[model samples]
Target: MNAYGSYVEFDRARWAALRSRTPLRLSEEELQRIKGLNDKISLQEVEEIYIPLTRLINLKVRAAQYLDEVTSAFLGCEPVHKPFIIGVAGSVAVGKSTVARLLQTLLSRWEHHPTVDLVTTDGFLYPTRVLEEKGLMARKGFPESYDTKKLLDFLTRVRAGERQVEAPVYSHVTYDVLPDRSEIVDSPDILIVEGVNVLQVSKGQPVFVSDFFDFSVYIDAEEQEIRNWYIDRFLLLHRTAFRDPSSYFHRYAELTEREAVERATNIWETINLLNLNENILPTRGRADLVLSKGPDHQIHRVFLKDL
Candidate 1:
């Protein structure tokens, strides 16, 4: 299907109406935090971009449950409920983390809903040492650098409702996958997997990462705008968090402001932008929904599969 179209301009009012009739998950505290960090992405964006999304996902979950009940009765057995998996994918600076975090809070607070778990594919990244040993350090965010087999196994186990499963952790400050630590997943009613390549196609002939997803979303934006956002975020982090002596990026932080800006721009142009174009952007069409963002870093278009 020819899903891509020229970007149409619209005002916030249109967005609000289109995204109306949905519930939001933000508590006053969470709303304040989001508001403080993201002036561009506000409560309105959540109402428009994420609220309708949650409603769609909730229906998907309830439908899956209904199917289980039907199948169980057909087989003369009790219903077997499983967690609903939602995979959110996008470029590095696309705010997918916020999406996952928000959904976790909202989905859990839904009347009588079970716990919602959030995980990132970063946790499944090969540890720095492993990547270095395998000659994949330069290809860090690329698919080849990941332990795809292990990630698949983790999802397979989670889908089957494993009693206790541990997911390796990644430290943003260190900018490395942790070698010795992981987060434990007790079963939850819902699981949200967010990352640049979370929805990537599997190389195996018979199955892939997407095979495990009940629903998937692609956070979309123009290449130039995304690149700019990445650079902006890098600069912001460098001036703030990166200044901490204990920060893993402290060495970069110690550089002259000009030097740091040069390095950040170069990395954005060479690594992240390249990865998004080569590996991630092509998969946007694969998502059940595509949230196309404009220069302002707010959603401008929503392309959903016609049911």
Candidate 2:
């Protein structure tokens, strides 16, 4: 292992060796369904990168449970059911959602944690109407655009082991929070919180979002690679989702290929790139583990915080 600051860095081969014969529990079809658009993830990628990562996470979860149990017995109180929380953070098109889903699936299959739930910070974003009113429509996905209090309260309740906790839902079709809809999260063995802002530490807030995370992962890649991925995703959406009449980006479907590419590039430069540089990238060092990807969209290096 190569020591760098507080982390121990491992190349792909070294990291893959840590799998320790952990059986691959995922099928190809399932992997396809879990991957995000324009994100390249294969069964081989799962074996080499994610399987070992899941093994590490499984050990962490078991240890946490044991510690909690021992502490409760020492305190002469019944052990409370507390789900292990994992936070997945990355830039807009860096495949944060895909990683989150993969972890949720793999972690659940371990049998010790069969009920894993996945939640995205997208659900906590303010409605488009609210954003427009606050003049934050252009700043959507920025920290100020979220309902942090509501998100904190939701996380607080979940961590408190409250039953049937509800979180607000957002719709990409309308590009807004669904006023009448929410997701009910019952007590589970693990909850994977995924989003661009999962690791953000807001100033003046006594409790930050990352405070609720038991484990956090940061997906890392070179800025130019991420920009290209974002553009590719946008173009794919323009040819597919943007063509749907109800999609928020339906107007983009009418643009010529050149115009679409120009629009996507402009948005990436003005909004996504700015957010990544100013806010998201700065938080990478705070993560417990960093998965650095190569231009091929596969994790090439793993930087894990030393205990």
Candidate 3:
């Protein structure tokens, strides 16, 4: 229906020309890190989109903190504290992960905040064993494949002003959950929660993973472009990470190039694309902002609902 499969049509050049008043600063080191993911990281996009976004979120967080302080003072509390949670959601291979990581670094560097942390919803996915037990391997990214209750519990604890909470970590190399290990979610000035279905709303459930978010973002792109990106990233991984003996997907590396690409395409068409259409796409409207990307993978425009 639109360039990015959204109902809205946009012109990249015109949108890029819309001057943003937010300050954006990135050192060479920061640029290099972003380039590692894709060499096409433009300072203009960062300035026009992410910078304004960070400033808006910063203001919201500050307002939230102030209101919290007033409420605490009214109740005669000793201290007021809680991390601001920002949720990033999108289809697979939409580069939302890179955005989350970048924002975590950039926002933390702001003089107003001392710490920022990035946490992913991947860790909340049910383990391979559990998935197999429930016969949900084919539906891995589907809502039913996740431990929604545990995810809700973890978020509730995080929202309750808990000082520390542990989230399980998933190892792509091992293709399994690291049962004995966990990442400490120490309190921070802000927490970036990034994942495909983090913004999903299950109609039947009274609880949802997105309830914990203070702000949410949806990274949007056309389905064909997303599928293409997924295939390209898979091919890249096949040449690099999948070549490692420790890589769980190494089995595919032994195949001929044609075979490997075929398998990757099948997986993308069947699993990832299906999940995106059925589960993730429905949540775009729920985000506080939607970052619409062009076919070339650069952002075309941003849509923020009226406050």
Best by TM-score: 2
Per-model TM values vs. the true structure: 0.91, 0.98, 0.91
- Least lDDT summed over 10 consecutive residues: which range in candidate 2? 1-10
How do these models rank on TM-score, best leading?
Answer: 2, 3, 1
Model 1, position 103, has a per-residue lDDT of 77
- The candidate, 1 or 3, that scores higher on lDDT is 3
Candidate 1: lDDT of 263? 89
RMSD of each: 2.7, 1.3, 2.7
Sequence-dependent TM-score of model 2: 0.98
Ten residues in sequence with the least summed lDDT for candidate 3: 1-10
- What's the lDDT of the predicted structure labeled candidate 1? 0.78
Model 1 weakest 10-residue run by lDDT:
1-10
lDDT tens per residue, model 1, 111-225: 6346888889998888888888998887889988878888889888999878678888999888787788888877778888888887677555476888888888888888888
Note the residue pairs that clash in candidate 2: none
For model 3, residues 19-119, the per-residue Cα lDDT tens digits are 35545668757766764343255776677666767877888888888888888899998654688899999998889878897788668867766688887
Model 3 TM-score, all chains together: 0.91
Off by over 4 Å in 1: 1-25, 34-39, 202-205
Which is the leading candidate under lDDT?
2
Query: Which pairs, if any, clash in model 3?
Result: none
Tens digits of per-residue lDDT, candidate 2, 1-307, equal 4433589999999999999989999999999999998888999989999999999999999999999999999999999989999999999999998999999999999977899999899999988888999999989999999999999999999998889999888888879889999898998989999999888887778999999999999999999999999989999998899999999999889999899999999999999999999889889989999999999999999999988
